[model samples]
Target: MAKPPARLAASPASVTPPLGAKPVPFLAAVGLGLALRFLVPIPAGITVQAWTLLSIFVSTIAGLVLEPLPVGAWAFLSVSTAIATKTLTFPAAFCAFTNDVIWLIVVSFFFARGFEKTGLGQRVATLFVKLFGKSTLGLAYGLSVAEALIAPAMPSTTARAGGIFMPIINSLSLSAGSKPNDPSRKKLGAFLVQSQLQGSVNSSAMFLTAAAQNLLCMKLAAEMGASIVPALCGLLLTPLLMYKLFPPEIKDTPEAPKLADERLVAMGPMSRDERIMLGTMAAAVCLWVAGDMLGISAVTTAMLGLCVLLGSGVLQWRECLAYPAAWDTLFWFAVLVGMSGQLNNLGVITHFASQVGNQLVAANLGWPAVFGLLNVAYYALHYMFASQTAHVGALYSAFLAMMLATGVPPVIAALSLGFMSNLFGSITHFGSGQAAVYYGAGYLTLKEVFSYGALMSVVNLTLWGVVGGAWWKVLGLF
Candidate 1:
């Protein structure tokens, strides 16, 4: 007799949330804006228009945090409200779309897509594993090195860690009998997962082009008369720091190199497309590193590289148009940047900074003490943030303003806050997209995530705060 038809599992809900929006957070955000607009008295030397803009900006930030609607939607609505209320002219509200930094980031996303399409990113990771997978610690370092190498070209941390490296890690773990949710998990899987996540975080901190928000931080810093140079101290120290903090159960993995070797052999050789991508990336990096001295802007360098890809047919125009993340970023990024610039123009940020600085100045603390306290607070505050870009957008400028008002050096204050923007992602599973990806892999327990994340925050703060301070001083950055 034939068996009865089997029952099918239900389909999961769509990844995209519906447009109808959640009510509680929505009401709370709108209420906060209205309360601030009506209840709070305007401070001395601030106009009603500036105060109104501040209320709208605050509401938008709250909406971003509560996420009653998609971030882009919130940004769009905020801009629209600003125009309708006559707080800003249409041209003034849309001016940031012409920003060079915005285009640099958008084009860099296309560069990242080239890395993904041509498989160069995967090849780089596989080669590193094959070269350094003889021991568990060695394997960790290998992955860190690969992440640092590709990070400048790949702006999306999730794409770099989750899409490229995680697959290799999963395969290696299983090959060595370390399956998730089983007795053998601790043997190799958990350690590799944690190590890669930490490594990616540090790599993101090391370069300006490594992450989208780093560019945002750069643009904001420039507005405050500070120039942020990429710092190498974090990248050099992160892997070893993580190893000491979170030691793996399996100390040695004799089969790891062999496994990596098999994968590399199967990948055969670099294709023509990868070669083109590599040359384009190399040219772009060289230009970016020396562009200022060579009279070329970073944006021009990125555009030049992107044009090469398009001209050579390495990436089609159609593919570039289809990249949702790049376009999505361009839209919301321009809106937030324009609004933030207007706030600065209207003197809201400066006024807010001076008021806070006056109180902190009364404490009679040294600049170093003030910076240390502010830095720690800034790092800890990431607990309340889910997106690094949003956190930087909302707080980085204000924090830098306060630091400057208290007599902190421009480069030091700017670079410190910028690096912490990436480092603090290690503090929580939802702190950033990459963190969510690693946590969701199920190799780590909740206790492990929090404990290790907290410890790493301390280590990262000390490393960047003390050692990085000394390094920057030596380089005359201060």
Candidate 2:
């Protein structure tokens, strides 16, 4: 089973929601689904078991949206509900944990936690800035490239952008006479923050371990016998797009090199942990990219790398156990995968797919025509979601099924939906964890962030969808 999409928006400062935010709408959503299960007529070819699972799935999604409980809690309940109703047994409910996808992400999280504890994340960023901070545009791309370099080792964009890039970017903004309330605010601060936000998401999409949700999508694609196309199409174009879209007042940033040099010198040489982290990540990525040819799965290589880190004292076992976000992701992703797998086995997904096919046929839509419409609808759904992972978890699988119904191949559906999951973060400040941190920096007002976010969404989609998609087609991804 593929993993559940993770905390695509786990922020550095984990803010709790208001308790008084009513659960009434959530309850209504679940109740309405329950009514549909009994009142609505099931078409002839569908099984009662499948229809029941669909109702439960709908109610579960409502609970996820309403958040009367945390996302993980809803996942737990959904799996338990399947068991209680004999939709699946306990082993079936728990089987997703045994799958390779779940463990790959689990180990990836441990590797990331090592980066946080060892100060290795900062070292990577500072090194890139020191080498590339010769000009304003160059410095911005430097930061972007730095994020991309370390993205393979870190799963949390919030942790990557918020924990590492946010502070560094803020200081860089101030040093360039671009403080929040000053007249020079527009000079570099806004551009820097926007650059960070856009850069993080695109880089996150480049590698499987770059973002938590990427791994989930990878699993789904692999399960469908589809390739994820480990190509650099997005990376090749995203920086150029940012260079064109986000221009600053100043060009030659002579002061930036001096600032970065001073900071690098003050920090001194890499610590033992940082050295180990750099080496471990380098080896891990090589294996991940070539593992299939070498007869080693990505999960096997990742787990071995993690064991080396732990045994070498770079990351302690207790620290890995205590990492809450990783644990949260494990619980939710595992259960959600189990539930989704069970639903597919029970024919609920097939029935749902057939229904969608009928509707598209009625509308006289061809496969490609329906696909473009669905892509836009999928991207637009990001407005209702605060976390990219949540949006992916709630919609990705079912919608991918619908894409299949359009007579499109699974690989096409998988890549399209997977790419959209990360790009959705570019649409709103609240759309992703990194977006939240960048927006909170005060360089851009809410309206400005949102407006620019919307603009960048179009730019990113065009580059990725048109340019990147053409490249993937060359690789036979479609």
Candidate 3:
């Protein structure tokens, strides 16, 4: 396993990884999965389902083991195997590129790049620091609030949090006295980093527009004939109600980092790039929100945004062309969505759902009991997820099928899974993209990360399980 970085300064000087490390764990997982599927006696029609689940599990385990491979690389390997094995055809695998949600993410990436290049994101962060950096708790609250407010408008969490706020978090840690090997300083840094991760993960679940995965959930639910709006309110309100669950001390020792605040502020007045990109993004969002009424797909709105971005020179062709995340995202997402289509095509999802549904019904569990049990199962299932997309792609279908078989409304099931995806990511340091970003920063030790993640798990599970469930029932979703 690669050693975790000792502090933020230890990050590779460049964004790319050094040469000679093994490809990411996703590759190994795919290889092993393919080998197992080929050599094992699993049913022919069910082979894809087995391999998909195992690949996800192996990649996640590899992440926790501290493997040096990039997360996206692992995702690629898994998708490749599914294609090579003929479990999913190339056209089907490549279809995720055309997914409305994927296009939305791609367009958002361009906007985030503009934010970074034009200094708009920095100015926003600095403005927040000025407003809330007076105390430690205030800084924590500021970071969390900043992410929550921005999340609704940003489709890609990595682009929004990683691209925009990651540097800010790094600078904030330095300001908080997070020096290399200083236990006290490191502890502070860990708390702040985890705070930001949790805040982003939790708050992003609130709105349909908050995260791409949430949209995937809604889209999937729509395909299944369930409503998603009811679930949205639960995710939004539960996080606010659970704010007190985090350790109380993040608020105690407040002190703003003067240097970071000034640097962020000094970047000053929006540039041409910022205005054009921001305006384009805002316009795209307004169109997306009104898409249902206008009878246009959200993907069409995103493509419209992409066209303006490319045609207007807000971002050069080179800059727009340079983003590999879109391709990487499409590669894996395509495979999984394809695999899902296959499973549904083969009636495998329906079968699995029927089996699980029968078990629940036989046990005579009521709706609340069923909800609790399924969520617990969903939470445990995160031990197998390194990527949120991988989790949603691999598990949501099966869970939804079972929920439908059990007579649970599709909206309730979809919303529960949506909230669970974010909550489960809070269970470990490498549980989601944002968590990995913080973990890679190196201010937090493995033990510290685990401790904080586990602490937040209690709060998240309780809030979502108890309050979220009640909210669902009160809203007549149950």
Candidate 4:
């Protein structure tokens, strides 16, 4: 029998309340926000604030469409428009294509492909499931922990957690008697879904090397003349935060005494792929940490890793090209970078930044309060963005400028904003790529995703308030 199309699948906003359920009113609210930006006019010059708001609108429009092209593509288009309009120059338009951060993303794909092709990823996943596979929730923790452990070595959070872990979780949940279409299984499936997404985001955030944007944040910080040491600072606190913020569920407890035997047997043994991946990954990590010591750029180190994998016949040239997301990601990032250059060149960003900065100064705020305020505002802005790289590229400079104008030290302002950029993804499914991946896993409805994400945003903001203050004090940044 031909199947009837699912109502949710057929409609826009399938995972949430139907568009008509709250359509015009919701859109009106968004329109109001956009209108508010124009209420207090700023002088015309390259302004970060103007670009920030425009980026927000673009991101919102893109997320709603869910087109085959990712958010990054739209980002490119926006930048191109800025250039065509004389908002940016030719050199700035193309600079992102050559960015070190962009190269890091490219080379990481080669390494990831080599690892994935080996089928070793499945063995590792299976072994993890065997250890924690007895209960539904145990599987969640196992997958989450495994991703966290591997994130430092694997630059692609989507590849490590979303690509690798998500499939295993889906199959295991099905194997454990959670039927995919069973209405009763919805809640359980949703929980499993959240577990994987949360794990990916949390683990990715823990390591600077975990996501491309995280590395970009480090580079951007360095460009601003701050020494926050990406390798040293943020990761130490990741595991602790993951444990505290990630909740343990009661339903995931095993009904029978769990055994490690069958899963162990089913996994067979590791192959050449496993050993190769492990070696390559280990070598990559060493290079990442020791790159500065070895007098090499991180991009060079990433290229070397790619070369090792390709030259060794571990991953074929065509195979590397076939990995869709890597190139796709690059295109999007390049576009965003171009758009940023345009915003700066056109003088739109500067004008907007001045206006916002003046407003904050007039309010007579201190540094810490300004930090908290900007942090909240940025994350709140994420509700409209589906791409973190695009959002960060488009807005970081303007917001950073605003913070500095408010008497915050440049170093403190830069690093805190960089950290908050990654932290903001927890606000909505459309806030970041990883968040979207979680929603697509078919477990979480839009409402559930938003609820948890919003809650986590509050948690993160509170943590930022306390931890950021101490870190500032420790470093004498204030």
Candidate 5:
């Protein structure tokens, strides 16, 4: 009954407890908003309300980055400021509470809860290990397959990687004599850790529901008359790419499948809850895939699945309320979406885009060349960010708007940036929630994280840019 690592002790969906606020960062955040509101002259084309809202939005993003308060607190503050300042009316400020994309993400969190509660997620990972755990590389692929299979229902990448897979990965590495901080660390732990971390990033990019920001990206893309669907090209290539870039010390892991088999046997057959959970997940996926044809929205499909789980006793209503991550996500996501949508409506985004686009236009580059440059710039900028949701909230709309203004095709501009929102999470130890989980395990050194992260970033950009671009063309998305 030893305690788990501090990072792993809390519920997977629980918010990190706030350290007492830093007075300097807190003042800096407020100062930034005030400076933008008063000191900076409003551009001629932007309305006063738009200027006011922009100031609040910028401050909120700064608060997120600086951590003057918890993310949910910052979001709540932003909504209150907007309403109090008369920048947005009550309904206008809270309209995104009913947003379908926001609900879809919230519901998906419950889906993840069912997976964790019923132990179905663990069962799936072990089954894959039993099938493909004969070698280190094979084990990485097996875990990647499991990651992709469950990603759509799991919005929190941290929950998927940290809750289900990390424990099992720790067991496998230990049994193979690959303890962290020991000479044998590189034998299996280092390679598997990095491989699965990158694999999670790839899976996140492949599905709109895999990470919360993805649904935000989708809603933003839809504003520009472009749509994003599940992507398979990158998910199919991640394992092989990671194997080449970060080769494991132990080429063969003979004990992995045996370990997996033993664990599976110990768990016995899938219980009633697991079986019902599995069926609900399957029906949800099918409905989501054909949702447009069936005239059902993705959110509607997710709600239906949640209802089924509730009715079948797989998940109780009290448990859903106790799930802090879902409610926290709902609050922050709705506020950000509300403000972002209002910015679009007020032409703040368009005005900002035209200002930026004019400079790029002056370079006299073709739209293709502009796209390449902006794409790289956007992906590389993740080093400055610690949260994907913050980056998207602060920059995604503006960048997408600039691309459109510069005459990039709608689908290419919108969806390319949308996917890159998740892909860039591969770049840093602090890049996303799951990145922190893997890095916190004390397995990989700082040098290893940076070096492999950079390499994987390059590979992802190339694969998605060339291969994904070609695939989209064939599908007539462009």
Candidate 6:
């Protein structure tokens, strides 16, 4: 037999060979999981069928966290395994894509493609720059306003923040005589970069169609039969509060406004494409906001808007596929939603909730008190998570289930968890999908982003808990 190459003593300790998995960590995780599965006793009414399904769900979730493969791949594996093991029929396994909410996400992404392909997103951002780009702070607010304006039409926060806004903001920074790693960075670039990143989070939280994860949370909430109305109040209040709390140290700047004005003059009037897109966007938002009363679902409204954009020749079929984020989101998100729905069907959510519920009852906790604790803990836990989608996948269903089991209103639990998913995005530099784009600009240091994020997280959460509670009380969320 040919002699096997000797495995080099695994480095001088911490370092390991590249281009492969870390066997120790992967083995540890899988072994720990196996131990839990075979050793732990099952409770009454929770069958081995439930156990198998839960194991598949958890293993895929671990695959998500460890990231041994891409998230979409893991999601695919979750569904495929469920079918292969007969834990779910083929129809049930693939049923998530057929969900109305899943279509809402897909159609929302098509709108995003329209926004990008039509140059409407850039045109709108420039208008904000022209109007409010008078001072550095004004420019900041303008960018915030621009983001919020386009948020309803674009569901991917990364697409909105990274693809649409970052290019504009980057140029603004360069034009204002600011360069990355240069001493002049703090003059205008640093402040704008940080403010806009925060603003992106605000906008993402504000609209249901603002972020991919937001749609995912909504779909999961709907699966649990929960309404998302309470989230609206928190979303509405985030932008202004972020501006007030995280004000730039360099408050006044004449250069930013001048630069914005020059850019506006160069761009000239809105093109035919921009005008049509604006009208289409307005119609979509009107229908979305009035959906419940009109008996027209949000998904229907989005599809209608997308069709007009395509039919009007403003957006082409090839252009829709060209935007990779939209397609990537549609595929991965559909699978995740399906897996979540399957787990719920298998009694996984109820079983997990009952376990947590028993602990709360044993501790003599009331709903109001527990509610506050849960929200705070949920927000704080973001420190341990890097991806909002991963965080939602792991905790949202369980947390919502536990809250529901505790006699909390489904709306209260659903909206709090849903909004908090975005709120937590403000707590770390790596908190959300778009965090890296802003952080990589080299304007703000990691420590600055983290500290500022932490401070503002508390502020936003308090605003929601205190002011939002009052708003909800007035609206009878109680």
| lDDT tens digits by residue: candidate 3, 176-233 | 4564346655655655666677666666666667666776666755321122332333
lDDT, model 1, position 148: 81
Ten-residue region with minimum lDDT total, candidate 6: 222-231
> Candidate 5's error at 133, in angstroms?
4.3
Local error of candidate 2 at 192, Å?
10
- Off-target runs (Cα >4 Å) in candidate 5 are 1-20, 133-140, 143-254, 366-368, 374-478
Ordered from best to worst lDDT, the candidate numbers read 5, 1, 2, 6, 3, 4
lDDT of 6 by residue, 1-478 (tens): 9999988775566675465455554565455556656788767778887777666666655554565554466567667877897877888777756655545545555664555556665555555556776566677766767777887766656545544566566556655556665654554666777777765665676667677677778864432212223344434444345446545445555564566567677878878887888898778667655665678766677688878888999988888777554555556556655666666666666555556556775676888877876777667665544467766877787778777767778786787788788778766544565664465445665456776777767667777787667766766667
Off by over 4 Å in 4: 1-91, 139-260, 344-354, 365-371, 377-422, 425-455, 466-478
Alpha-carbon deviation at 224 in model 1, angstroms:
21
Residue ranges of candidate 3 with Cα displaced over 4 Å = 1-69, 135-137, 146-197, 200-270, 295-303, 306-312, 324-327, 330-350, 365-368, 378-458, 468-478
Which lDDT tens digits does candidate 4 get at residues 269-379? 777666766787667667665565677666776677677777777788898777665676566645554444444445554455456557776788887677677767766
lDDT by candidate, in order shown: 0.73, 0.67, 0.59, 0.57, 0.73, 0.64
Cα-lDDT of candidate 4: 0.57
Q: TM-scores of all models? A: 0.64, 0.60, 0.62, 0.60, 0.64, 0.61
Q: Supply the global lDDT for candidate 6.
A: 0.64
Worst lDDT 10-window in candidate 3: 222-231
Judged by whole-model lDDT over C-alpha atoms, candidate 1 comes out at 0.73
> Which pairs in model 1 have colliding backbones?
none
Measured over all alpha carbons after superposition, the RMSD of each candidate to the real structure, in angstroms, is: 8.1, 11.7, 8.7, 8.1, 9.3, 9.4
lDDT of 3: 0.59
TM-score, model 3 to reference: 0.62
* Candidate 5, 27-109: lDDT as tens digits: 99889999999999999999899999988888876776676776678789889989998999999999878866557556766
lDDT of 2 by residue, 1-478 (tens): 9999886786866867667424685676568668878999987877887777767766765665555566577677777877898867889788877756556556656665666567765555455556777777777767777787877766667656544576566556655567764545565877777777766667776666667687777675642212123224445445555566666777775666577678778879889988987788778667665664688766787788888898899988898888665576667656755666666676655555546545764686877787776777778766645557666766687777778877777777787788788877767655665665566455765556666677777776677667666666776766
